[model samples]
Target: MATDPYADPKLEGVSIRSLPKVSLHDHLDGALRPQTIIELADEIGLDVPSTDAEELADWFEDQSDSGSLVEYLKTFDLTTAVMQSADGLRRVAKEFVEDLAADGVIYGEVRWAPEQHLGGGLSLEEAVEAVQEGIEEGEDAVDRSGRDIRVGQLITAMRHADRSLEIARLAVAFRGRGAVGFDIAGAEDGFPPSRHRAAFDYLASEFFPVTVHAGEAAGLDSIRSAILDGRALRLGHGVRIAEDLEVVQQQGDSVLVTFGDLARWVRDREIPLELSPSSNLQTGAIAAWGKNLEDHPFDLLYQLGFAVTVNVDNRTMSRTSLTRELALLAETFDYRLEDLEAFQLNAAAGAFLSVEEREELIELIGEGFDA
Candidate 1:
């Protein structure tokens, strides 16, 4: 078994970090190690809020807990500032995969907007190649350590920007190289997916897999646009889909509810909801439900048969990992091994991979959990 550096908060006497997990919504720019940020920032002569690694980590967490997605996103400015060069992007991407492997992630898809990293004279193709080189290096490093991990890139575009079509082409251009999928992230409320119709049309024509950032800072309209216009195969933090559900009666896990058309379609179709427990709370994505982890609609959605998969959207900002997210959910909702396994299976099924690869991942999860 691979050693887990962040192993803690054991479930049923088993370290949650030792169990296999799948990360579908993790951000490459958002998962940098604080020390790496400090080093990279110094190399680029960029000023950071804190030179000390621990203080920088605390700064990111404090800034992200502000109960607004826009405010929470501001911290990324510092991280992305340093990621403007090939070396910076490569190092960050490498460490991101290494960290995920140490946290027991067997398969992960690292998502980031390539357009955001072009400030340092890197063309779109060069930027993607740098990150891909880092990903391959990380996978090899894990293999050398007697463990195995696989990570793919989800090339993303900023929804507020008009480069979605260009970025979509960039993603499709790199298919089978490192990019596995495409996404549009950033300020989900005012900038709905409908604004990027041209990119979505192109992506749909190419038959590329997509997952849109919706239902986090926005309500059902954004999610509806993501499905209708963007044709998102999965939702990034689709927690707000709960707003479409009207609860009629509830007692423990047995609750009767009325599902709005949107929620019904998402559920009946088994569309995966990339639910991030801590990041959701920090960004107030779950404020409609309550203010605590226990207040999250995850349990409700899971019980109602939504394909709910746990994720750590931003590890540095949230100071979280898939292990920590699973631990928090298990503690809050009293879930067992089987419940955690179910979440991984859902993520595996929703992953942008061949059906055979997903089945292989599923078998790995079952074996890991059963052990």
Candidate 2:
């Protein structure tokens, strides 16, 4: 991989890593450290693409860069393979939070399908419990380091699978225990959120929050189903929501646009769009627009009043963090610290926490940025 501008760079004379941020669409399976994967795979006698950590990291980036969604999906097979065991799950969960804290994240939600971790004979409950244990441990470590951080699971159901209702129940059952929300992830094109109406119905009845993976591989209808059927408060990588917009022209530092009903509603209603910059590029989610970060409709969405929040969909695959993602966006759009702070505030408000807690996070972000 070539050099990343924000790998460890400072912005406005302050390290972007030092400013507070919030991550809403991160994946537990996609944030593992390369070295952790090596050790975990070795313990389970699983073969990896490379033995060395750096080489393994490179392999992930290479495979993900193929621009084929199928190839991008293959990278998860390697990650979830080693995560089937309790120890592997716990360690990865612990490191996930630590990494988030290190990157100046005050709050984050790590979403993963519990069903996929059952190959090692662990029950769904056991998998959730194990990850919870690791999360608590990670929080303690960060606290001892004199920083505050919290993580919650967005219990996910594979959209193509038949376990939607079951996973919905699982997520609701773990509420206030470790799980904070529910989600449906996986092949979004054919397996629309409407396919799991029963699950969404159950979640809605129980008053549990849901975020669906839509508008990434698919387009507007997928997002509509995600909102109408899934009843999702947030759209995971809803970048394709841009499809609903008609850009008339781009003037100097301004854009003229028209919105379809769907786009207008999402914007006016303030439904959060969890946009991941690098992952969207790598998975070809933004291919319709263009290939580079500047081509991303993120600026347009922000300017148009959509509740946009930045994310790192897969940290390892994209080799990115929230810090790096914000940096790249700043470089692409010439955003200042206030622009970055606005993104963090959007995420904090959209977080699945109590209103009071979200307010506190907002204050924390203000303090961090003001410092």
The candidate scoring highest on lDDT is 1
Question: What TM-score, over all chains together, does every model reach?
Answer: 0.98, 0.98
Model 2: C-alpha RMSD to truth?
Answer: 1.2
Residues 1-371, model 1: lDDT tens digits: 33444457688788888899999999998999999999998987888889998889889999999999999999999988998999988889888889999999999999999899989999999999999999999999999998989999999999999999999999999999999999999998899999999999999999999999999999999999999999999999999999999999988768999999999999999999999999999999999889999999999999999999999999999988899899888888999989999999999999999999999999999999999
Cα error, candidate 2, residue 213 (Å) = 0.7
- lDDT of candidate model 2 versus the reference: 0.93
- What is the Å distance of residue 72 in model 1 from its true position? 0.5
Mark the regions of model 2 whose C-alpha exceeds 4 Å error after superposition.
1-4
Weakest 10 consecutive residues of candidate 2 by summed lDDT:
1-10
Report backbone clashes per prediction. 0, 0
